[model samples]
Target chain A: MRSWLRSEDSWAVLTGLLVLLLGLLSLAGVNALGWVPKANEWTTPLKAVSPASKAFALPGGVSVLLLYTSLLGFLCLGAWRMGHSVKRFAVGFTVLFAVGYGCWVLGHYAHLATTPNKMAEKGITWGLGLTSESGYLLALTAGLLVGNFFPKAGEWLRESARTEWYIKTAIVIIGGVYGFKAAEDVKLTQTVLVRGLAAIIEAYLIYWAVVYFLARKVFGFSREWAVPLASGISICGVSAAITTGAAVRARPVVPVMVSSLVVLFSVVELILLPFAAKLFLTDEPMVAAAWMGLAVKTDGAAFSSGAITAGLLTDDPAQQQAMGLTTSTVKVFIDLFIGVWAVVLAVVWAYGVDRKPGQGVPLKDIWGRFPKFVFGYVLAFAGLLALGLWLTDPVAKKAVKEGMEQADQLRRVFFVLTFFAIGMGANLRRLWAEGLGKLALVYAISLFGFVIWFGLLVSWLFFHGVKPPTVGGN
Target chain B: MPDDKRTAEELAKQQAEPLLPAEKWLIFGSISLGLALLGVLLWLTGAM
Candidate 1:
């Protein structure tokens, strides 16, 4: 078990389970005792107080900040003990503390500033929609400049950039949100689930085939470049690129390069997909929401785009709420496929592609290479789903919702950390030298020529005419 | 004399990078079809 905790996935799953357990317990105890925190309330604005840690506030009004900072410091210390330099850990922790909290505050304010309702109240009439794209864009840009122009600082920042762990943990927490949120309207969720499942299949089959062919035939890339590039273009870009890199046994640079492209293009899609979805698919709103999931690969970009698209296109508040829910359902459906997709690809690579003749691809290889944190995600999802099903009582149902509300808040904090970590690791100059110019061209052509249109068509075919209930209680 | 010769041979090998597998087409093609089927099953049962 001590050895097990060294792995990123194992730590993520254990932490996620701990979070889920604590949330359930704290909510249950509070309900039973009729006690509540003085300053405990859930809202998106910045107050230095968090829903999750508010119950345990200290004498100073700095409980959440202290807890959050300590959690990161411990993670840093863990990495240091695991065989990193003290200087690197020191530099990394400083940057992580500064950048993580900085991005959170900036994203919060950007969200408030760009919100359409707020802008409308000020008589501005036109503003960026509900999404928090501005802060992420700023973080990515600052990272790129630092990575290229000030390489020393970037190196320090990159010390704590455990992008995979951060993202994986958030994904595990997202599973709980699904179980809790999906219970509200079973019918709509089922539809989103089915359609999203079918759509991901089409996406994997059609999109991967076309982009891969283009990479090989058109761009003249070798299999390593083609496969990772295709994976980044076809499915959830960051994880897909990493998985393909490992499956193909490519160099470490290959995944990093591919991931850089994914991060850059995610920002592009963040700016473009929502406006396009609104322009075309307003009446078929759910389709637009699903298209956001299919087209944009990163979680922040996809959900932010969905929120913006939903806000811009729909005037009905209930419809907007439905759109938000449907958006998560579709995105999680696509995100969950990475685990299964990784296994299948590993088998194909080991057995069918790169193996020495007569050397069998052992099952153990696949299991070892497999992402174990995915089990935590699926288990959490299933547990919550079961919980939702069993909690037929009204009070029990309400408790589940409140508990998950805190979980989702923590998930967003993890996601914001993930964004900073991903950005810190990226260097545009390296990306360019590693064939970003060519890769960018291929990515653009693949995304615009096939990915976006195909996603739109399939989304429309499956999710068209599915309107959420307005002016009715679930 | 043998060590020098071995070093020269290793340097030559280091400079040459191998091309990707010839079986890539067959690999991705077959796997994509299989994944599609798996996806259909998942959708049919709403399992995932």
Candidate 2:
């Protein structure tokens, strides 16, 4: 318990919670702490001043971008101060922030390049539907390229490339965003929430177990590698891999390995799933939607796949709309699995698996093993939801929405930083090492062969007859 | 003496290692599935 609280994960969670709490409170006009980021004060929408100018047009000023980066950098500096000189840490953090910001800007440009309206202004068909997440991919790619080519620099810079810390904070912010979105449309959320609950159960009991067995029995992986790998493949990818690694007390390398595989595979699915859906599953589009929820691992990629799917097949607008909404809903709904599953894995590991051969673990050890960030995540999600529910006044709700949006900006920055750092942290050569070779093979067969089919089956099972809320539909 | 030392090291290593506690996780997995079901019920009834 002592180590658990003192652990960097705990500190990061506390940091994220306090940042979000203060920001939200400030929005509610309770900004007693003048230093805190006031609610709705984080960002402004893009200003469309000079109509023909080539600059960012979105809201939330660039100052917050700098503020969020510096604040997070110092928090990281505080987290790592024990390991490095203050001056060195500060300098390294500046470089890290500069690189991340550059990538974010480049990514923003890529988004603008793909926007339909922007492209139409140039007489180009903006077909890709790429969003700001393109920046995350660019960051990851750049980080990997740098890390692979310059091992010496990779080693040195990795001192500040704290990927896990950044991601956990983003996830907590997402909890708030999710809560607000869920409350924004209770009917839609409820529908997705109910059906999505069933989809997750089928995923864990069937998808997770099957993949786990494939890793262990077929590929001959040890238990530690296989468990986290199973969760990574079966559940929500990178986040699930990290959570499972912690629950099982596996070394950090295990989750890192599994996470790399997930990122690579998710991209592949992101590209292939949409085209595959349009070509084959257009007839039974909900099946494609469910398949998307089952197949696409991360939020960004799943959403991109939905966008692509919607853009491509235009035969039935009603069906396409349903497919798009269902795909996003099911995927977002699956994002909720991390908190609950982490709780389950924690109890199992502390009490059941990690006990001594002839010895038993104390009940309190569960506290140590349970991922502390999950509490921050769940509390933020539930609190935001309840707040949205209770504060029915339009002005109050609008204020909450603005604050949550600002928090979301913070979350995206962290996510972008995390992907870059994960790329930096990964040793590409080791990815193809002997053990991982088999791991890769297992991922290939399972993702392509089993996941797609089973996703379609279960999605059909639960959502076949349950069509989208379309009017005068046959 | 060396033999005894090796045995102690092995024991410590075993004690330190992750024990692949799949069964306990199985029980927990069931609990998670149940909670997911509860989520569905609550959402349907507008209690969530």
Index of the highest-TM-score prediction = 1
lDDT per residue, candidate 2, A1-474, as tens digits?
Answer: 545455656766766776578557746665322322211201122421111111323333445454556675666555553344555555555666667756765655522424454465434554453444456666767777778888887777766777656766766676676676666556655665566666667557667777876776666666677777888887778777776677666776777667777877776676677778778865666667777877777554555455456545443444444565566557655656655666666656566766546443332433444445656666777788888888868877766665665566566667667767766755666546543466678888888888878777666655655554443543
After superposition, candidate 1 runs with Cα above 4 Å error: A31-64, A77-91, A106-145, A245-253, A278-285, A298-355, A434-436, A468-474, B1-48
TM-score of chain B of each: 0.39, 0.41
lDDT tens digits by residue: candidate 1, A405-473: 666656655666666665555555543443245667888899988888878877776678788756456
lDDT of 2 at A283: 61
Q: State what share of the real interface contacts each candidate retains.
A: 0.10, 0.12
- In model 1, the fraction of reference contacts reproduced equals 0.10
- What lDDT does each candidate get? 0.64, 0.61
